[model samples]
Target: MSLIARTGPQEYECRVGVLDSLTEKLRVRGITKVLIIHGTDSWDKAKNYLTQLMDSDITLEFALFNGECTHEEVDRIVGLISQTQAEAVIGVGGGKLMDAVKFAADKSSGVESVLIPTLASNCAPWTPLSVMYTAEGVCLGFVIHTKQVNLLVIEPNLLLDAPVDYFVAGIADTLAKWYESDVVLSRPEYQTNALLLLSRAAALNCRDSIVNYGLQAVKDIQNQTLTPAFIQVSETIIAVSGLVGGLGDGYSRSTVAHAVHDKLTAFPETHTFLHGEKVGYGIMVQLAIEENWAEIDRLAVFYESLNLPKTLADLNLSDLTEEQLGEVAAKVAVDPILLQSQYRVSKEVIQGGMRSLENYLATTV
Candidate 1:
């Protein structure tokens, strides 16, 4: 596990008309040339946005991520910046691509970064942290440096068109921090009000957004009605969900919510789902283990209603058979690690949690 790095808000904005703020932020930084990093899945949309920007005096170059990023992709983005000497690097897309850009910026020299998230799946755009992937595209671990993004642009008008699953997954991922951060806050060893404040701020910001507009965001996506829902999601997924939640909880210690995400990823068949979808279910399982079934279950049903995974098989996970509980427990039993959780966590504790999860899935809708 990587050490936690507490980051300041630097700056946060969630008002209407945020996309328009991007141009001025760049100009103030004296950035004349920009290198854009985006994903191939959203290549056309990325191009459209880039074209709009090109109409301005700013020189622009774009690199579409072919698929999952590799060291080569990071190197390529860095190499492009070195060769082009672009004043800044801007990343557009989901969390993974953002992580790629942020890491490359850290490894590079002098070039600052701006983030424009096309989706709100994870708070990657808001945090200074980055997750590095191996050549094969597995998340090797995280890259924790003090580097922070200068500008983050979230246009709900843009994200409202992406699949509803992305919005749902974003909530799922954001919601995990509500539980995980609290778990960290409980630990006697890792006590810091400053840290907890950041974590709780992220949690509450997301919780409030979810309570108010989370359903609206989902309903808007389902109905394809983008007006109010787009506006809400722009803040919920992009601003509140991405930046505030990211700065608050992301830079803090993540307990079971993320650990479960990691362990579940070991089963490659589960790759079809988004990270937040898997993580949402992980939060459910964590809630069950902690014996706080009622609170977590209420949200799990929301996820179920949204068509997120509620069962082990739903995650495409079959390797974690009933017989494998002991091994899973032992593997997860890292001392001071599990202790940081909101509740006491042990091998027996996790086994009980898994058992409860199995039971919960057996009965719930």
Candidate 2:
């Protein structure tokens, strides 16, 4: 019999003050010695809560994250974990740090990992994949590990302290889960796959939650008040959005939107944009490629509402000549991941889509 392995974190906890109980959680997991891999800024913000862990019997060590989730960094941390003989790895910070720790722990057998995210920026903590990047911050691709995370702890109050842009970027990223996957799921060959059906429902749920509660959630964040709406949206971003990929498997993989984001990373100027912001514009390009003008209009209104990128100008690529933009389209057309789409995509198609989007934006403005 063929066996299918489904992976997820062994334990997950989300609450307002969960950080204060990190020691007890580790104790229950029988992790007596741990090495913490975290970003410098996040470590500073979380020092107060982290200090209490040291008061317990658990042996703790800290390593400042060097900032990217590259193979070299993973290898370096793997060496540190071996030298420290840590029973477990505690990744405390944003997505990149969590990815590094997860990749390192997965690469080194017998090493367990616990993720504590300081922002609700992406589903990196809940997912089993690490997005590997070049040392220069260019996207190489992602790596899927055989094992899932040991534990995931999310403190909502800690997330509240992150910049508003991170939260907005997260919303944009989560919304793409629906748009990107629904197109693939609608294909005839995938229509009856039970797992994909569940994933489709999850993606729909993500969309509904964001559509119904996103604005209020943004308002709550601006006001610095954690309301029911804010909490729901945060969980939707981190948890519900993750379930889409977790259940969908390969069939639900991101299509054109993320592929465009990866290609845009080739330009240093686009590096200033957040991951989700780039994906936001990518969604627009994908819609244009499908020739879905009405849907594009609706999404454009929503993008404006959330200050998401709706045009090339918003993506900081408006200054590029048509030839330069064509080069980007050619690169995106050839991305191996984008080729997995059920529909046939080509350089000419992507370039045409970009031109159409630009013309549409000009008329609307």
Top candidate (lDDT): 2
Compose the digit string of candidate 2's lDDT tens values, residues 1-365.
Answer: 11132436888888877878888888887889899898877777866667778788888888989999999999999999999999899999988888999999998879998998888888889888899899988998889888989989887877877888988999989988988888887777777777777888989998899889988998898888988898898888888888887877665658788888988888888888888889889888988999999988888888888899988888777798889888988988877666654545888999999889999988986
Candidate 1 — what's its lDDT?
A: 0.68
Model 1 residue runs over 4 Å out of place are: 1-24, 135-137, 186-195, 227-230, 241-252, 323-325, 335-344
Q: Which regions of candidate 2 are displaced past 4 Å?
A: 1-7, 341-343
Give me the displacement of residue 262 in model 2, in angstroms: 0.4
Worst 10 residues of 1 by lDDT: 1-10
